[model samples]
Target: MKRKLGAEDLFKINSVSNPQISPNGEEAVFIRTEIDEKDNKYYAHLFHIQLATGTISQWTYGKERISSPNWSPDGQSVAFLSNRDEKNQLYIINKNGGEAKKVTTLDSGVNSFLWDPSNGKIWISSKIKSGKTFTDKVEKEDKPLPKAYVVDGMKYKMDGIDGAGLVPQDSYSQIAVLNLNDESIDQFTTGEYQHSLQAISPDGKKLVVGVNRADNLDYVFKSPLLLIDVETKEETTIVDQNGYYGGAAFSFDGKYIAYAGSDHSYKNATHGNIYIYDVEGKTTVSLTDGIDSPVGDYAVADTQQGISSPAVVWTAANELYFQLSTMGDVRLYYATLDGAIYPASPEGEHIYDYAVTKDGKFALIAVSNPTFPGELFNYEIAAGERKQLTHFNEEFLKEVELVQPSDISYEVSDGNTVYGWLMKPAGFEEGKKYPLIVEIHGGPHTMYANSFFHELQLLAAKGYGVLYVNPRGSHGYSQAFVDAVRGDYGGGDYTDIMAGLDYAISQNDWIDTERLGVTGGSYGGFMTNWIVGHTNRFKAAVTQRSISNWISFFGVSDIGYYFTDWQIGADMQDPEKLWNHSPLKYAKNIETPLLILHSEKDFRCPIEQAEQLYITLKSMNKQVEFVRFPDNNHNLSRTGTPNLRIERLNQIVQWFEKYI
Candidate 1:
């Protein structure tokens, strides 16, 4: 008999990502990640598959994490980043098989790398210290003395760094080239700015990188694409507008560059568009001009691990292929230089990651659905055929009975249609009412799509109906709809969510309205706090890594200073306005028994947000509990330590079971 999905099922789930097609289009390689329950660690290795025979084999092994696998230009070797050594460094292994060879010995390790198409060299981006070289070595000491961090800029701290959320402000990411022939390395650009290497020209003479050299880097959010000459180090700003840009790729012919970004017209809620730039004509055209959906996958889920969305892929025919998030689905799309765009793959499933061949005939894609975790597939672009390539999660899936979420589309009070999904309780029986949990996604900018969500599945397994919706401030919708929540906070967006719950209850009579529970993290967490404070309808509520006071958030969060100005339309200068939209201001009105979950080092929302709420509720003799996770950042729910992730799920389910 099949059993419900337990918290420990996390150990059995295998996630596949970053599929890279061979240069000759005959084979493909991808990264398969599994959790080592004995060690409480994640182990990833490279797996290879033949396209014609559908045979798969493991190409690499060990306990360390591996990522960013790519085929060399000659297709004779595969290069990837691994933590087999202390830091994540570059490693290359022959295709025929053998032990992988370490390629880069940089002290700081490699951040990203690209294969030089014209020669035996690799362009990489690595961190360089203020006064030290990339190859410099430091003497080991038995007991090192403690050092103090000097007071510096506001961008000194970030989430998921060293578990304490502190980063060295003096270190900067710089570009370098490594010659595989002699194992010699050459440092290129050096500056205080962080450089993200994007793509290299077909001829290997020019490299495109994204950087922001603004004087006040904290306030400016622009990442302009700079075309730099490989030898001369001369830079030409190809996209210097007031916008955010990345994922740039040079066309096969080296005459055009395609990139994805937005003008930030709606601040963080702006939809991303694909633009093609003419290298010779110095002109740019938007390939997805009227496309309302955002480019790249915005489907929020925890089942996928180490997945990198494909940038714009250039075909030999001068066309481009990319992924876009539409109404609750991420689809592969094909575009032409003349500005025509259409779906390259069928709808109804989430295409988390993909790689297309140079000839544009085949694609290796990672697909997931409401009932499936994820797997790799070989897709024939022209014939619209998809063949399963890997069954990594087949055994685990067979032991658990998963529920498929039904589609939900309801009109809100503003005459706008909201999209979402509703999952019935696992092993649900008819004529029986069950408690319903309203799940909210973070990123008030990301959408809840047709993807497998482990948390929601666990909730359903525990006999709770789950309702998740993409409210007004969600991607995969119109720009106007997504930007509607800016400066409105608990206004229309709140109304839309409540209306969705009412609609779900109205359509399904088996929902127990009195036993309602609500939970969310980040922006969703803020909304959950707002919900409990505004209405006592929900019997139980759990808020995770949430914001309570916008005033304090303006100074504490890594993006708080500017994010407040962009999302809340207020800052420290306007304390009253900031407080008016803060959930902390309405703390006295909360009546639901609340459980606050937060990561101690979550710089995004900070544990202090949860502290204030817990303290305020405790002072009033209200039922409230706070759980603090140490040495983890804001991503505790998704990419935290495997043990902590399971414990988090247990906390949420136990809390709802006790109150609701």
Candidate 2:
């Protein structure tokens, strides 16, 4: 008997990511992650599959988290990052199987690493403190005293999985090379600025990385692609244009480097395009010129754990393969040096990550659709045949009754069509009118695609219709549409969303309009707050990690300083404009029963935004409540504490059940 998908099912699901094809292409290694219900933590282990026999085996096992699995040049061993010890360190294990050996013992551990194709040494990027060496030992004191954090620059903090909160002023990310044969570590790059490791040249003579060395790092958004000589320690600016460039890879012969970036033409809403730079000619050409969509996966979902977007890969044939966001779907694309582009994989599914062979004959892809959580698929590039390689979520799928969303296309007041997905409630009947819940996604720039979203499924299972759409500010659409929300936060974008809801209600009479509810996070959360303040149509609303005021946000959020000017077109210089656009300013007009969910340590939107809204409404004797998850960041819905994620979902369902 199939049961409705429960929030606790998160513990039962297995997530597979970071697939790396072996040099011989006979086997592939990937990270299989699972939640330990006993510890309320996520543990990942390396798993490999013999492509010829389709035999799967667990290569590494532990309770700790492991990530970034890569095949050695000779394919005799596999190297990955794991926190089995204190901090995340690099570890290596033989392909034939044995005890895993710890590689780097760096003080700060490894951020990311790559195998040098020529020298067979591991090149890694790790954080280094001002006065400490790579292998320095921490001296224990009799007692520790509390110290104050002296803030300096505007770019002082960042939001992420590891070291998420405040950044140390004296710390910087540096690059080094480790030789496993002699255990000798060569510290190569040292600087106050951070250097992100992109890739080592095929010949291993040079490395390409992204770094911003501007005088004012806070003001400049450009991280030019830099080519650093391995021996000479000299740097050459490969790309110094006014754009943000990353995910770089060198060609087979090391004659060209392919990367993805945007020129800030639309600020953060700009579309990312793939560009190839000639090593000798020092010229760059945009291969994806006419394609309006971004160069990577912008499909928004909550189920894929440890998933990363693939960089532009260079094949032995000199052609490039990359992912593209198109019409609410992420697809693999093939591009030629002469500027021709075509689809390499099928559409209707989100391809989160993929690895292609050097010969471009086969690809290992991690994809998900409306009903499927995610799984690895072995795709024959030439024949377009796809075979499932991993059955991580097979049992979970069999036990749950998941609802598939239907495609929706409707025209707004401006006559522009909007794309979205509508999921009928689980055990839905034709004559029964079900309450409708409007689900909005974050990144206002990210699209709500045809992907498996656990949150939406949970709502559908609870007998509520789920409606999600990529409004004006969403990707996978035209550049003009994506850039439409900038400088007009609650203006056209809000209308587009309201129009989508109106259109959805009109198209489906089974949707109970009187019991409408709204919920979203980040920018979506901002919109949810805006919706309640502007209209009383929604009977209940839940806002998560939302921004209610742009004035305080400019100083509180990690990206608030520039994001305010870029997205809202206002800054501290214009207080009136910021206040006028703030949802808190219109709090008095809100009548919907609101539930505010926020992470206490969310640096993106910050909890203060929610506090202000809660205080304002509560003081007015309005129906409002607040729930704060301690020690969690802005990513609570996607990758927060396992138990708390379940609690958060239950809160949402209970809130709707009580109010609607």
Candidate 3:
């Protein structure tokens, strides 16, 4: 056989995701994605999985992939948005399926939708003109104009698709009330922040949306909740008591609205807290109180995306069932309007997100831990029993050893306790000294939960101790705790992670601190870059998809403009503040060998940021090399092209082997 580069060899298989049970709760509908190696593309389709008999069936086919499916409350049909007609349009199908019927047509199409309680209507968040009448020449009148000269997606240029369409940024979004009967559309709040999460109240009249009308709304991490009295055309802020408040949902009675929110600090340790606002009483209470859990553990394979849209399942007698991840492991926890919260886990590993049955006796769960990938499981509360339904990755686990993360709590310099997870070598021996790799997570707003990450586990198997932490900005902590790291990015949160390292070295005698190495992507990438510049504690580092210069990052990155303001309360326009928060400001102090791995087409971080770091490191005579993957996005490390994914792993191994 010809010699093959593992990074160039493709072995990734596609997976199914976003499974949602029909309104009637009979069968689960999921989006199945397949990667075609020939074109290096992912094709998605809607598939139906039965809950009772474990039967599976395929629904859509051939031309386009269907996404974001919502079932009509009557359960007779399902509505989905797709790019099937070239422009994304609403398509509906019967309970079983015959042919999907097109339900709406406009110049721009739908991106997301919610069924209007079986009133033959669907509410979608899609681009629409502010005041343009439905009858006007829409393509000419309402089609978006480029807000920024070079749109981020589809490369840096607004390349003409046969001059067929405008750049996506030129494409603006609005929440539209789509009346399925007459194909009539009503625009709600043409006010600016690019509409998202259009949640209709249980009664289907009050629409709870994430709207940003303020000019500085762009500075906000997430849009504040906007409630619209659809019939009266009156709009009001549900609880504009600020700071990134999008994931809002109404209680069964519509009196209480629960949402997932985080304060305005973008420090690396931010985790979202559950907040409930009483509409009638006009009061707000921060739930997920005291029970802090890491969102996604560094032990798991993920892009560091934290929990948004907390899976809130309704209860039989007016209570709400939700999942909480305190201590980095997810568990099924239920709470009522009466203020009582209790555990509902009936067994091992841990419960994923819970699915509540209409009758409240059943809780459908996706369960797993370090040893297992999530499997479909069910808990019958009335029967007081739980059983595993389907094994998702049992075959794969048999081929490889999975690492079990050990919970570790240590104190910060401030005398505050911090939590983290330690993944030991697979066939660990107590006496052997192993090199330790600190795998940090991004999202300064995300977490390092106790999930499974093939990379971290594989690192441990390579005779390295893997340590991941919740380090403050990480979720599963108190809202105030998460908010603590903002503006103080490299301040306290930095001290926490470093303190974590110090504690680990002091506690674990087997860790070779001299052989220490570190690496992370995005904010973690930012931290990795920050760590090397601040101290030479780490011998080597790999910063993937990171921002080295916050000043330049604002204009170049797709999210930099907003991300900067969210993290530090100012954008690059405020160069003084931006520079003060940037890792690049102190680059001359960086002595550690740094490897910058970046995607060629990552709009989120953009390749330029990586280029700047790599160039500066080389100029300073520090051993540095940049590995740029083509045709990849911000998801380069977690969910990128297969050939490139393994290559990323191989590069990390090579970097550590050479430097440390």
lDDT of 1 at 513: 93
Model 2 over residues 314-366: C-alpha lDDT tens digits?
Answer: 78989889999999889999988988899998879989889999899899999
Model 2 residue 651 lDDT score: 95
Residue-level lDDT for 22 in candidate 3: 71
lDDT of candidate 3 over 1-660, digit per residue (tens): 112112322233234345567766768766655555666555667777777887777788756757767678887777777787788888998976698889877677666778886567777776756555333455464766755455334233221122222344444577777788788887665654577755778887788877666554333444667777878867767666445565566777778787766564433344556677777676888776555543222233532121122446565466766666555656677777667877776423445444677667776666556655455566786666876655545545555655688888888877778888887766778888888999888877566665556677667766778898988776656666666777777889889988888888888898987999999998899999989989998888999999888888887776666567767778746899888878888888998888999988777777888988888778889788899998777777766776688789889989998887
Q: Estimate each model's TM-score.
A: 0.98, 0.98, 0.82
In candidate 3, where is summed lDDT lowest over 10 consecutive residues?
A: 1-10
- Provide the global lDDT of candidate 1 against the true structure: 0.90
Candidate number of the best lDDT:
1
RMSD of each: 1.2, 1.3, 5.3
Q: Can you write out model 1's per-residue Cα lDDT over 259-361, one digit (the tens) per residue?
A: 9999978888888999988888988888897888888788889868898776789999998999999999999999888778899988789999999999998
Greater lDDT among 1 and 3 belongs to 1
Off by over 4 Å in 2: 161-164
